[model samples]
Target: MKNLLDILSNPHKRMPLDTLMKCEVVLEKLDFKRSEGLPPSGAQGKEQIFNPLLEVVNKCLQSPLANHTLKRTFGSTLHALNGPEIKNLPPPAKIAKVEEPPMEIPDVLQGEIARLDSRFKVSLDTMQTLGSEGSISLFAELQSARLPCVPPLQVFVPRGYPAAPPAASVARAAHSKPDHFLKLLNKAMDHKCARLPKNCSVGQLLDAWEMSVRQACAPNATTANYAPVPALGI
Candidate 1:
């Protein structure tokens, strides 16, 4: 134990890596004879013999240079020395947690959503207000019976609504490629919104979008007109 303590508290300002390795080997080989010379008084005997050794070992273990095997060996030796005392120790106390306040949507966006809910007769349960900027996202299903294949539309209302036009897109269908279709739809919606009066409501924008979708999907109508033409061949 004294030798181990000496190794742990080396007089050198900076111990060499090889010297530390030799010290570790000495520690691994040193036999901790707990039962041989210890006093018959259980806790008191162990405490007196092991306390200083325990302190040194703990400090060594805390060092950045202490590797996994050294830690495991020290842990096992300590556990064998005081297994009963450690097991008998009480569990730590629980900490009380404070709850945060719920987020409230802005009055202007809330009123617009309410109006949209009433006008479309659609549920606003799916609508989610995003961040402090007052932007919102929602999924709106097409009510047309003719367009059964078309998926629910994802609409994103920007921070400044009525002034800023909302962007809409459709999810890719298993049977059809909606990517091209969505690009045309959004482009047409933006063009229509740009032509609308400055004070146009979200509902009016959505109405224009629905009309565009119907026109794009019509049997006689072709979305190829909206698709960009290839550059003239050389």
Candidate 2:
């Protein structure tokens, strides 16, 4: 067996080509144990032969083509002598990189949109006022005055599409029943009148009521507060 460390140590630092050929000839002779008519021997003689073989192996390891050529020779010929096979070499690795897409304003815009959506329901409270019987009282007063009225007792019920005309349940209610609707309108008017200034006109009262209803429907709707009177006499 070869001394693995000795093979590593003298790894062909700088040997002549002719010396390399002579070393190969010596290695072949050692295999048959017929070096200068020396025959095979007992345990002590076996060790002596092994020492010389290891020296040759170490010398071969020092050759220029030692690493590649010796590994090939060992893998092929040394198998019959139960030598450990050389490990196959692995291929060189290929490295590839991925490029990420650019950052965008739209991504930030979408994040802002989502944030607003989350707050929309709660934020809507600022625009709406609750409905009470005051709304109902106003509906009653408009009817008593014999005014042509679409009594605005609506704005309270949850929104839905009308089965018939006007596309909305509130509009349908105004168109369908005039008298009964007026009764409710009057009551809503009376409630608002009691809270507002005594000199407030019928037109002023109606405006306030409409404003109130609009505020209830779209809590986010934009509108000015109810002013007492317009200088233009309206």
| Most lDDT-accurate candidate | 1
**Tens digits of per-residue lDDT for model 2, 73-149:** 44443464577668888987877875544322234323432453221211111233333211111121223222343
In the predicted model 1, the residue pairs found to clash are none
Task: Give me the overall lDDT of model 1.
Answer: 0.56
> Each model's TM-score?
0.43, 0.18
Candidate 2 structure, TM-score to reference: 0.18
Worst 10 residues of 2 by lDDT: 160-169
Off by over 4 Å in 1: 1-90, 93-103, 117-134, 146-149, 159-165, 173-176, 179-187, 197-200, 224-234
Error of 2 at 34 (Å): 21
Q: Candidate 2, which segments miss by more than 4 Å at Cα?
A: 1-55, 74-234
Q: How far is candidate 1 from the true structure (C-alpha RMSD, Å)?
A: 16.7
**Candidate 1: worst-modelled 10 consecutive residues by lDDT:** 225-234
